[model samples]
Target: MKLNAKGALLHRQLYVLLKEQIVTGRYRAGDLLPTQEALCQQFSISRITVRRALADLGEDSFIQNRQGVGAFVTANIGKTKHGPDFSFIGEMRRALKETTMQLLLLETQRCPAAIAAALGLADHEQALHVVRTRSQADEPVALLDGWIPCRFAKAVTAEALKTKSLHELIAGSFEQLGRVAQEVNAALADPIVAQALNIEINSATLKIDRLVHNREGAPVHYVTVLTAPMRTRLVMEVAADDIDGYNVGRLLHDVQQPKAPRRRQP
Candidate 1:
């Protein structure tokens, strides 16, 4: 691996490479990681940089560092038994059988600025907000917060939310469930969320943000879901043909071409 002078980039590169190795089973759980000096020589980086990368891996619960001894893999990364598929449509279909939702809060309130924008609502517009905890086999696994426009708020009720997934409720209210845009990000749980999930404060969590559109392509609702890392794993399956449609050949050609520098203004 080549080490760049850029400190942050260099650190991240080493971390990602080691993480990939561990996740791909090249370095199995309980396997000892290379010593700091060895890693430094392999990457041609300083001990400080190696330590920084290792620290990040430790914080994320991928490895454990022992004083005088080397770091060892703590958990089996990329391995889960019957984990929920990361696709929204797939997960919703499995929700009723695999999990249950307990309604925590249901009320009409002024939508938060960020959520309002996602739902295509004017600033300060009132919206229906619902909060619930999703559990599997009686163990809390996720916390969901959803916001829908006031026009459709009346249709959602506490009783209904307990028996149905948010998507199911939304689908019943809309003519069609149009395209859904989703983003998954890594985050640490705040105090309130940590307590709700019965996990330690600042524990690793997955934050999924979704925006649903109606049949006419109008925004329908915005949702944010938080899940503990230990209890949930997100997986996405894509076919080879689907990957080929990305036009990687064209992208590689564009990447190989150099760009001319823009002329400076007088």
Candidate 2:
């Protein structure tokens, strides 16, 4: 494996990559990692850099390093399980059938500071923003605020949103919709969100942020989804090898009070 010159982040990047390998069973539990010299030469990095990366892996409960025997994946690194393909698109299609959608707002305008940054738009650049609510059995369950780059705005319309997901419409212009970086946490419903979701102001809610990239890894769409805490639940079928899912499951934190959901540029 080769690593690019990322300066200070190079070590941290290496740490994360190695951690992923272990978590995915590429380097299964009890498997010995390459020696420092071997890793240095393989990655074309310095010996010190390799040492730091390995040290971090050991500290993270992913591996154990012997004095001179090199590093080995921890015996209890993670629990592995088998499962079927739970394609996200398929899940969305199921939701489309189960839940009804109402498009509340759809317009192309100058992007907000946070929205522009998340969608990789320049200063004052325009984007299509959509606000919609999802309901099941006549009960509002989710309020979604989404922003898309102007280039993809053509494929998105008020009517299209009621039928197709944002990702589906946007992918028409690209080879494929690639990876999505998502985060979920506790948040409080704000005035606008509370009213849209038919919940009381300051009510607890679950906030989800998803940044989707094109096949080339350029941001295309960013969305924030808020669900009434009492009416909705986030569920994931996770195994040790599902690194991203496992991490998401472990990171849910309890909050002391309701707070407005914060937007972040990934």
Candidate 3:
């Protein structure tokens, strides 16, 4: 109802209001929300203002807009978790049992400049970049892009790649996967990913940037995992020691990947 600095109506604020209600369970999932016209008239604002507020809600997966129908509350709003790795691959499977994975393209190539930085490598250093599409049931869910330093790449075969655990492959090759650092945030799916996932160009997804280390505490791998939002949720649990040790520095709040058998959707 209030106008923000841009002299535009404060849709983000209004979005928060509606979102809070849903999160608190006041407005149950599948409950129909006020129509654009009704909201505009109620707030004494223009339809554009109402639309903006609704769009903000839609963007965050707080609600769904049905064409020619009405906007309905979504069941997947606050259920998403932003936390530590705590086993990301397993968390994803628990969130969506219908998950499946297929190697879109896998080959050995010199790591690109961008990829090198991602993997913490020197220029001209060789690494293997494996690209694959992960789906939930039949729908594409995420694009798993992994960069493995060549030293460890030899351990990962095409057959091995088809399995569920890249972490296992790395751990098997080396002695252990001592530590891992990851960053998770919201991002728009790029064109290639959008097309492959059958989502919009700017569709929101969960992006996980990760780096793995060996027991000697040497950085061994870097990866970026992008996943679909609607059908997937992320979960993380923190231990008390992690808090006392100030381990929460680079381990800031939040939560990727595909491996394992394909399960039929229930």
Clashes of each: 0, 0, 6
TM-score of the candidate numbered 1? 0.61
What are the TM-scores, per candidate, against the unseen true structure?
A: 0.61, 0.57, 0.64
lDDT of each: 0.79, 0.80, 0.72
Better of 2 and 3 by lDDT: 2
Off by over 4 Å in 3: 2-26, 29-32, 35-37, 42-98, 112-120, 173-175, 244-246, 249-266
- Residue 148, candidate 3: Cα error in Å is 0.2
Candidate 1 off by > 4 Å: 1-80, 83-87, 173-175, 238-266
Clashing pairs in 1: none
Tens-place lDDT per residue, model 1, 175-244, is 3688776777888899989977888787779998878887778777798889987677667666567565
Backbone steric clashes in candidate 2, count: 0
lDDT of 3 by residue, 31-149 (tens): 89988887776666678767888888898788999998888999765454345446645554443344666777667677768768866788878777778777755888778788888
| lDDT, ranked from best to worst | 2, 1, 3
Tens digits of per-residue lDDT, candidate 2, 1-266, equal 78887553678778867877887678988898988888888888898888889988888788998997889998886575434236666666667777998888898878778778878889878888888898998999899888889886788887777667777788873348877778887887889988989877776789998888988888988889999864565666555676674444565556788798999989
Which is the leading candidate under TM-score?
A: 3
